[model samples]
Target: MLDTLSLYVAAPEILLLVMSCAIALIDLGVQTRLRNLTYGLTVATLVGVTWLCVEFALEGQTIYAFGGMVVSDPLGNWLKAFAAVAVLVTLVYGRPYAADRDMLRGGELFTLSLFSLLGMFVMISGSNFLVIYLGLELLTLSSYALVALRRDNANATEAAMKYFVLGAMASGFLLYGLSMLYGATGSLDLDQVFQAIASGRIRHEVLVFGLVFIVAGLAFKLGAVPFHMWVPDVYQGAPTAVTLLIGSAPELAAFAIAIRLLVEGMMPLAIDWQQMLIVLAVGSLLVGNLAAIAQTNLKRMLAYSTIAQMGFVILGLATGFVNGSTANAQYAYSASMFYVVTYVLTTLATFGVILLLAREGFESEEISDLSGLNQRSPLYAGIMAVCMFSLAGVPPLVGFYAKLTVLQALVASGQAFHIGLAVVAVMLSLIGAFYYLRVVKVMYFDAPLTATTVSAPADVRAVLTLNGALVLILGILPGGLMALCADAVLRTLAG
Candidate 1:
């Protein structure tokens, strides 16, 4: 039986679970016109929970709960805290957009967002394969419903179907891989599986086979090629509000699961999986950057850009081990964590701008829709420009520092191939800059299509201003955040 005290380690998840259920029930009593009540409650819940997670992260202790099925550590805690903030910001930025489209018919958005956030919390804390899968299913199922929230829209319905189909297939692949790992190791706990593999009793070939499928499933989840067929469709088809919800925070959860499965569970086979990641990384960079260059729709372009950004995350993972030495593990993992954290920050602001521009009848998803945005709202245009510049890895922005840390990790590996790969990554990033800059150009130089002024709620404006400022602030004085990531990664690695 689980001890009562151990449960404290997962108090945030427990509290969030109860709060989400409570909000769901309470939302029923909320009048149609009073959906803001539910939204307020949901945001409050997230804020309270975020505070709890922040305390845990700052504490920086690693604790296991429920017979080691879940963990409480700085990495998971930080990710959960940030995920809560991201979801809160998503709801804030999305509410007006959803209300404008009549998509806030009920408390579905709030309830579903909370549920999805619960799923992310679980994914971050899970240490067992079954726990991780359960979290993933919960998150993906909520996302599917959220995407199809506007059932009247054919595009949303179709996108949901595609997402469901691909997500199901990816889940199946992950399950099979887990099953194979279990059969080989006779354990479902990640640590035990690692020990089993390290013991040299399991067949190396069988482990490698399972790794192939595991990597594929992770690739699909991360939207890496060739498993990224659904990202563009879903990004473009879902309501802009839904896109904001899907695009931002869940990425942190994906990073958590990747750490759980790859770094913690499968480090014994790093050489094998690292090779697979390299291929996925290279392929995603090529496909994402190249395909993004051809996109006229901003949403689709961001989706491809997401793939390319994930490739950098994978590239960070690939550099963790070279010539069977784990010397660079801390730096590599910390760099990846930094990249993911900053990327999510940039994405929230980017989508916040998109959501702000969205109105009752206009989607504002086209690059041309942004033409002369500076003339209409220099604040939003500047915010969008900052996001684009950050994404493009320009100096004095978080994204450039993120890319620099990742590339530094690779080069620090001191392998010829790793250096070559960094060079190629730089080249591809240069190519990706074209599209990001084009958005800036459209905002700054082109003629305005509509003279209507850009407007957003004060709360949204405040949050977005803070979000954009953090991207630049983190870049300019990256030491604090970088140290935070390093501390978290080191704590996790120590465990």
Candidate 2:
């Protein structure tokens, strides 16, 4: 019993479990007028968990649980902290929209979100293929329900169906890959698999095949070029709150998984996987950035931007610079992590503006809908401008630093071909800027299509203001966060 208890090592997961159950019970019995109670409880729990994660990060202890199935180190600790912050922002921005649509009660959404977060905790700390698969499934199932939360909308139902089908196919491929890997290495643990490959215990053919399939599955999750077909439709059709959660949290979770699989599990096979990732990264950058240029809907454009961001991350990881004594390797890892953090903040701020602009019957999501935003709501328009500039990778914003880090890393370690690819990436960034700025121009320079008053609830405005402010602050004082990101990546790489 003591050992079993030890298996539940992380305080954040334990707190989330208890809070989710308690909130579910309260939601069932509480009066309709008190539906916001779930929101309050959820926020409190997230805050508590975040505090614990921060404590653990400062303490710096690696706790292994479930016979090494899960382990909490600085990497997992920081990612969980980031996840909590993102979830809190999502809840704040989501509450008003849910209330306006009569979809705020019953605790189903909160419970699912908490559970999905729990899965994210597992994914970040997972030390074995079995644990990773379990966490991935939990997160996927919860997200499926979340996308379908607005059951009355046909588009929601359709989007959920498409997401489920594609997700299942991806999971199938992942499991098949895991099975083959297990068969070849005779081990389910990632560390053990790495050792098996390094010691020449695993057969080359089976190992390669498994690696390909696993990469394929993860690519789907990251929304890379060929595997990203479902992202735009899902983003546009799902509730804006659901979109925010999916956009911010799942990408972090996927990055954690990629680090585990590539850096730990496939260290001996890096040469092969590095080449494959380069191709995927280039394709994703080209396709995602170019495609986003044509989008009229803001959400769909963001979906494509997410794809392009993932490409940069993959490019950094594929450089095979991890083994050198040069600063190139450190730069590569820091660049990728920096981009991840920057994208999270940028996306949250952008979506927060979207939520604030949306009213009872109008979503304010289309590009044309933002016309004359400056005249109607100067504060909201200013926030939107900050978000747009950041996304465009302009100087003095976090996004520019993030892009600069990645490009510098690539140039420092890569050959002529990779340098060319990096140049293409730079050009794509410029192209992407055009669309992002176009939205800003419409908001400030064009005429409003209607005379409706633009106003947001206090809670939504507060959250948006904080989010917008953070982008500027982080851009100015990026050293601290960038160092933290570097430390996290170094710790993972060391492990």
Best model per TM-score = 1
- Compose the digit string of candidate 2's lDDT tens values, residues 375-479: 888888898899889888898988888888888888787478778878989998888888889999999999988776677777777788888998988888899
| CA displacement after TM-score superposition, residue 307 of candidate 2 (Å) | 1.0
Q: Rate the local accuracy (lDDT) of all candidates.
A: 0.93, 0.84
Q: TM-scores across all candidates?
A: 0.99, 0.96
Q: Which stretches of candidate 2 lie over 4 Å from their true place?
A: 4-8, 320-327
- The lDDT, on a scale of 0 to 1, for candidate 1 is 0.93
What's the lDDT of the predicted structure labeled candidate 2? Answer: 0.84
- Stretches of candidate 1 off by over 4 Å are 32-34
Could you give candidate 1's per-residue lDDT for residues 1-495 as a string of tens digits? 668857788788888889888888888888866397798889889999999999989987898888889999999999999899999999988888888787887888898999999999898899999999999999999999999999899999999999999999999999899898989999999999999999998899999988888888899889999999999999999998888888888989998999999999999999999999999999999999999999999999999999999999999999998788889989999999999999999999999999998863699999999999999999999999999999999999999999999999999999999999999999999999999999999999999998989877789899999999999999999999999999999999999
Spell out the clash pairs found in candidate 1. none
Model 2 steric clash pairs: none
